[model samples]
Target chain A: MTDVLSGLEAGFAVALLPLNLALVMGGCFVGTLIGALPGIGPINGVAILLPIAYGLGLPPESALILLAGIYYGAEYGGRISSILLNVPGDAGAVMTTLDGNPMAKRGEAGRALSLSAVASFCGGTAAVILMTLFGPLLASFAVKFNPSNYVALMVFAFASLASLVGKNPIKTLLGAVIGLMLATIGIDANTGVARYDFGVPDLLAGIDFLVVVIGLFGMAELIHLVEQQVTGKFTILPIGKSFVSMADLMATKWTILRSSLIGFFIGVLPGTGASVASAVAYGTEKRLASDGDTFGTGNPKGLAAPEAANNAAAGGAMVPMLTLGIPGSGTTAILLGALLLFNVTPGPMMFQTRPEIAWGLIASMYIGNVALLVINLPLVGLFARMLTIPQRYLIPLIAVLAFIGVYSVVGNPFDLFMIIGLGIFGWVLRKLHFSLAPIILGFVLGGLFEDNLRRALSISGGDWSILVADANSLVLYTLALLVVAVPLVLSRRKRMALDTEA
Target chain B: MADRIFSGLLLLVSIGYGVMAFTVIKAPFQYDPLGPESWPRILSVVSALCCLGLLARPDTERLDLTGKTSTRLVVLLVLLAAYAALFEPLGFVIATLLFCAVLARILGATMGHAMIFGVATGILGFGVGAMILELNLPAGPLRALM
Candidate 1:
C-alpha cells in the first residue's frame, strides 16, 4: 500500500510538470475534436499525431501522457456524435446511438450529454483507482514468470483473441499467422543471418510497426470510407440548457457504479474492448431495470450504462498493457507500439525500472478525466460543431496526414509505397470481414513470443515438455487450453440454440 | 467463393514459405540448437494448417465490390502509387499538392476547391515537415527557395 502511494506521489511529480500538463490539455482538446468528427476516430487521431510526438523528442512519460489523454478524450467525445447526429463516431459508440439519439430527439440532448459526461467521469476515475491498487500487484506477480510461462501467456492471449475478436476464428487465426510471419522478416537476432529480407536493402532493416499501424488503421480507414462514398449532410441536434441536476446524478449513481466495475473487468481481459463492455453493460442494465421496455427509447440509465462502461473500459485496457506487456485491445496495441518506439519495454520489470512511466500515466488519467469533464461540459457546443466538417475535406486530409506521418518516420519514399500496399491489404481484409486487431496484436507480440519460446527451449535443451514442467507454466497452459476450448463450446451451443428457435 | 480462393492461395504461399525457410543457409558459428530457420519453419507449418482448416470450412460471405466502387479504389490506388513514385523526384510540396488535389477531386470536390485545398495542404505539410518538426522532406524544384 505504501509502495503504491509513494509510486503515485513520484508519478504526480512527473505528470504535473508544466510541459506535460500542457501536452495533456492539448492532447485532450485535439482528441475531442477528432472524436467528434464523423469517420475520424481515436486510432486515426493517435496514428496521425504519433509522428509529431516522435519528432518533438519529448520525454517518454510526457509523450505517453499526451497519447493516453487522446485515448480517453476520444472515448468521451465519441458520445457527442452518437447523441446529437445519430451517427456513431466509432464502433464502441454504436450502442450510444440506440438511446442517445432518441433522447436528443426528445429535446433532452443537454441532459443526455451531461449524464454521459458525469458517468464517463465516474467510470474513468473508478478504473484509475482500481488500476492504482491492482497494477503493482499484478506486475509483482508477473515478475516471477519464466520464459516458458511467458510463452503460455502469449498463447493464452492469442487464443482469447481468436475466440473473441470476430465471429470466425479461422479468419482471426489467419491474420495472426500472417502477422507472426511478418515479424520474422529482417536479420535473425540469435544467428547473424537475414531470414526473410529477400535481398532488398530496406528489407534488411525490417518493417516498422508504426508504418504498418498508420497504413492499416489510418490509410485503410480512409480508403474504406471512400469506398462507401461518404458524402452527405449531417444533422446535429442543438444543445439545450447544458446542466444535469443533482437529483439526476443521484438517480444513476448505482448504475454508474455497477457498469464501471463491469466495464473495467471486461476491459482488463485480453481481446475484449469497450464495444463488448458497453454491450454487456447495456444488456445487464436493461435486464435489471424496472422499465426494461424503455431501453431503446430514451432512458437516462440506457445512456449512462454504455458511456460509463466504455470510459471505464478504456482505463481497464491499460492495466494489461502496463503490467503484463500484453495489450487488451486494438487501441492499447497501438499504445504498446508507441512504447516500443520510445525504447521502453512494458512488462513486469516496468514497475521497478520505469515506475514513473507506469504510475505517471495512472496519475495523469485522474487529471485527464477531470480535465475532460471540465473542458467538454462548457465547450460541448463547440466540439459538437466539428461534425459539420465535410467528408471531402476530412478524407483528403486523412490521406495527406497518413502520407506525411509515414514519410516522416523513416524519411524514405519506400515506406510510402509500403503504406499504400498495406493500406490496400488492410482494406481487402476488412471487406472480407476479417478483423485487423488480432493481426496487429500478433505482429507486436510476435518477436517477444518467439524469443521466449526459443529461450525456454534453449534452457531445456529443446525439450518441449519443459513448457509444462513448472507449476506456473502448467497453470498457464491449462488456462490457454480453456480459453480456446470454452469459447468454441459456447459458440456451438449458441448456434444450436438459434437453430432450435428457428 | 472469395474465402476459398484466399485460403487456397494462402496454403500455397505457406508451403512455399516453408520451402524457403528450409533453404536458409546455416550460420558457421551457431550457438543454439534451434537456428534462425526453426521459428519460420514452425510458423509456416502452422500457417499451412490454418489455411487447410479455412479451406475445409470456408466462410460463406463473399466480397461485394460494385464496378464503380472497385474502379474508384483502383484509381485511388494508382494515384497513391504515382504519389509515392514521384515523392522523392518531384519533392514533398509539388508531389503532395498533386496527390491531395487528385484525391480530393476523386472524392467529389470541384476542381477549383480541390486545387485550393491541395495548395493549402502542400504548403502546410511542407511547413510542418521542414519548419516545425525539422524533418528533411525532399525539396525538388523548390530546393533553392527552401
Candidate 2:
C-alpha cells in the first residue's frame, strides 16, 4: 500500500508539470497519426522523432515521456488500421487482424475498433499503474546490481530471448550475431578507438539507431511489400461501420486483464519485448477460451488479448531498461541511446540523483496512457478512414516517407542505401520463419554485454574467477545454462525426428 | 540465388569477423572466463559452422527470385544506392519523389498512381520533414536561396 501511494505520489508530482503534460499529449497524438499511417510503427515513429526531440531542447524526462506516449499511442493506433484494412501497420498488430478485420468486414468495424480501443485502454492503464507501483521497487533492486551481476543479467536476457521462439535456434543465433555485429559497427566505447568503421566517416559515429531502425522497419518493408505483391485479394470495409458493442467489451474484459498481466511480466524480461508478449498472450488466450470456437473469426477476445498484451508489454518493457540500464527491445535501446546522449545513464544513480527524471517518466506513463485511450477511442472513426486509401497511392507515400525519414537523419544517403539493403535482408529473414525480435535484442544488448564484460575483467585484473565469485553471478549463470542447455537438448530431439523422416 | 550464394557469403562474413575478433587486443585466458574477443570470435566460428550447416542441408523454403523480380530488386537497390548518393545534389524533394515514383513504377503501379504518389509524397514528406520532424532536407539548388 505504501509502495502504491508513493508510486502514485511520485508519478503525479513528476507528471503534473505543464510542459510535461503538453509533451505527453503531443507525443501520443503524433504516435497515433504514425500508427494510423500504414507500414509505420511506434519504433519507426519514435526513431523518426529522436532527432527532433534532441533538437528541441527538451529535458531527458520530457523527451522520454513524449517518446513513451508515442510508443503506447502507436500500439493502440495500430489496431485501427489492422481492423479497418487487412494490413498490420506493425508486426505486433498481426494477430489483431485475425479477428479484428473480419469484424470490420461484417460491418462491425466500429464495434471492433471501440472494443480494441477500450481493451487497449484497460490493458495499457492497468500495466502503467502496475509499472508505476513496482518500477521503483525494481529500480531499488536494480541499483544494487554490481558489474558482475549486470553481466550475468544481460547473458540471461540474451539466452532467454534466443529461446523465446521454439524452433530455429540456429537461425536465432545467426540473426543475433548479425545484430551484435551491427551494434559494434561504431567506435569502441572503452578504447575511444574505431573498431569497424572500415574507414567510412559515417560509420565512425556507429550506425545510428535511427538509421538501422528506420531502414529495418520502414524502407526495407517497402521493398519487400513491392516484391511480394501476390496479394490482390484483400478486402476493404466501408468507413464508419459500428464494430463496438457493450457486449464485446464485457466479453473481452477478463482476457484483457489476463493478457495485460502476462504482457507486463513478459515486458519485464530482457529482450522479451511486445511481439513475444503478444504472441504468447494470443497463444494463451486461444488455449484458454472455452469459446475457442469464436477466436480468429471476429472474436473480440481474440483481438483484445494480443492488442492488450502488446500495449501492456510496451509499458511493462520499460521497467528493466530504466531500472537496470538494460533495454528490453531495440526501440528502448534507441531510447537508452537518447538517454546517454543527454548525459543521463539510466541505472540506479538516475533514481538517486534524478528522482524527477525517474519518477516523472513513470508518472507520464499514466497520463500518456489515459490520454491515448481517450484520443484513440473517439478518433477511431477517423483513423479507420485510413484504410480506404487506395493501395496504389498508399505504397508510394510509405516509400517516400521512409526514404525521407532515413535521409534526414545524419544527412547521408549511404545510410539510405543500408536501409534498402537491410530491408531486403529483413524481407528474406522474415520469409525464413525466423523472428526479428531476437536479432534486435541481440543488437541492442551486445555492447552492453561487452562493455560490462570488459569492466568486470578490468576490475578483476583479467582474473577468470570474478564472475563465479558472487551469488548473483552464480544464479544468473545457472539460469543461462538452463536456458541454453535445456532448449538445445529438447529441440535436438525434435530435429532428430525430422532428420529421421527426411 | 539465395541458397548457394547466401551461404557462401555468410561463410565469408563469418571468417572475416573471426579474423577481426582474433586481432582485438584482449588478455588471453587459459580456461573459462571469456574475454571480449571470445564471444565475437566464438560467434564468427559458430556462424561459419551455421553457414556450412546451410550448405550441408538444403533449404526447403527455396527463395524463388525470378529474373524479372531479381532485376526489379537489384535495380531498385542500385537506384537506391544512386538515390542516396545524389540526394543532397538533387534536393531531397526531387530525389525522394523520383525514388518513390521509380520504385512504384517498378513495383507495377500504373502511371497515374506513380505521378500522384510522386507529387503527394514529395509535398507531404517536405511538410513532415521540415515542419514536423524538424530534420533538415537539403533544398539542393534552393540551398542558397533558403
Tens digits of lDDT, candidate 2, A293-374: 8888988889899889988888888888888887776567677777876878887667667777777887887788788878
TM-score for each model: 0.96, 0.88
- Candidate DockQ values, in order, are 0.69, 0.37
- Among these predictions, the greatest lDDT belongs to 1
Question: Which regions in candidate 2 have their CA more than 4 angstroms from the true location?
Answer: A1-16, A52-57, A230-233, A239-243, A482-502, B1-5, B24-39, B49-60, B104-120, B131-134
- CA error at residue B113 for candidate 2, angstroms: 6.0
For all candidates in order, state the fraction of native interface contacts they contain: 0.70, 0.33
Docking class of 2: acceptable
What TM-scores result for chain A when each predicted structure is judged separately against the true chain A?
A: 0.97, 0.88
lDDT of each: 0.86, 0.75
Per-model tally of clashing residue pairs: 0, 10
lDDT of 1 by residue, A1-502 (tens): 9999999999899889898888888888888888888766676678777776776778888989999899889888999999999988777898889988999999999989988999999999999999999999999999999898999888888887887777788888889888888888888777778877879989886799878888888878888888876566677798898567798788789889999999898888886778878988999999998988999998888999999999999999999999999998888988898999999999989999998899889989888999999998899999988988778778878877777777776788889999888898898888878888888888888889989988999999989887888888878778778878987898799999999999
